[model samples]
Target: MWKWETEEHAKAVVVIIHSAFEHHRWYAWLIEKLRVEGYHVVMGDLPGHGEEGKYSRIHDETVNEYIKYIKNLMESALSYELPVYMIGHGLGGTLAVHYLKKNKVACAGVILSSPWFALQKHGSLIKSALANLGSLTSNMKLTLDINKKALTNNLQGYQEMDDNLVYKTNVTVSWYKEIQLIMKNLFVPSTSQLAIPILLMTAKQDKITDVEQARKWLLLQSSTEFQFKEWPLSYHNLFHDLEREQVFMYVRDFINNTTRGLGYIID
Candidate 1:
């Protein structure tokens, strides 16, 4: 767990949840920027991420377990006794949605960046079906074929990803099975509507998550105040792309404006 505070008072505390196969250290750059903006920030490493959990070995985990982890981590920020907001990336973003819907957390708002609400197909239907069936064994391990180029548009970013310390390339069948169940529930609207504000950021060139599908599901939620920003010239990892500073600026401006009750009007 890591927390950064500014001398000046902050409107709200922001908890950052990093993407899949990554740890809290990976978000240092973004955290520093948040601190510079005078926002209190808290971050943590997920169960299967960080140095303790290596890519060569991944545990069998379910959707429920992932949600439990997220809830526990957010409790640290809750101790501050301030309105807490969440900024989650990729898989972390999906977990945030599940956490918000299930628990009555006193969060003021949320930001989801390239959330994996829907997945892109990498192979034929038969192969996909086999993999899904294979997950029933629980011990089955599937190799992930991550295209480095799809991670970011910047050449330097691509090289850095190749050498990333906490990167995971192997996923367990049970993990995929659990993720499928979570995705199914997300597509269907919830009975109790979400009341807090949301900012859903979609990548135009994302190769991992389905941006259109995410937009469609988000539009179905009518009870929440929300805004959607489609970032162009970006891949799945928008912040690690060539135009990272611009992306960070957009997020900073959003949080600042939201704090002052000057949220950007929907187009």
Candidate 2:
């Protein structure tokens, strides 16, 4: 885990959870932005990802492992004695949901960026059958064909991500199965409402996850305060896209609003 303390008097701690196949390093831009805004940043790689994935690829990862990882980060963030907020991207967003459901942490709010509750594309029947069969073996690997261009429109950001060696594009059968199970339970009626304030953002042109599903999920939420915004021209990675400055502004506004609502004064 890594923590970036704000040079100014910190207003709150923001725990960032990155998307699948990516690592904490990819969030340098966001981390610095939050720090500059007087918010401490804490983030790290999930199990079987980033540095760990470099040595051993994703295999046999369980849902409990992901939840536990985020729980530890949340605990660390809470140690600052400031309001703790969570920003999760893609699969990380889904993991955040699972973590919140299982653990009763003192979180100020949450922001989900294009959460992976459902995929944009479903596999063919044959491929689905193979994946189900492979789940029985649990160790079978599948190389994901992710389109870097579809993630962000900024040429420089796209180039940097494409050249990054830490990103993993492979997933094991068990890992896929685990994620599928989590997605299935994400919107169950019994646990649909999250008491904390929520900000759900989606890219209209996102090709990685289903935007409609994300919208549907947001509508189902019964949070005390919830907001949904769809970026018309952005792709999957809203923070890395061309309109990142605007996206950051929205995040800042959300934090500001939530903090104020909680009777916390922000300097």
Best by lDDT: 2
- Cα lDDT tens digits for candidate 2, 1-267: 999999999999999998887888778889999999999999999887777777775545777888888988999999999999999999999999888877788999999998999986432235657556543566767655565777998886676566445565677666777787788888788753677999999998898898888888877777869889999989999989988888899999999999999898877
lDDT of 1: 0.75
lDDT of every model, 2 decimals: 0.75, 0.84
Provide C-alpha RMSD values for all models, in order: 3.6, 2.0
Which residue ranges in model 1 land beyond 4 Å of their true spot?
A: 121-128, 131-136, 156-166, 262-267
Candidate 1's TM-score reads: 0.88
For residue 80, give model 2's deviation from the true position in Å: 0.4
Error of 1 at 43 (Å): 0.9
**Clash number for each model:** 0, 0
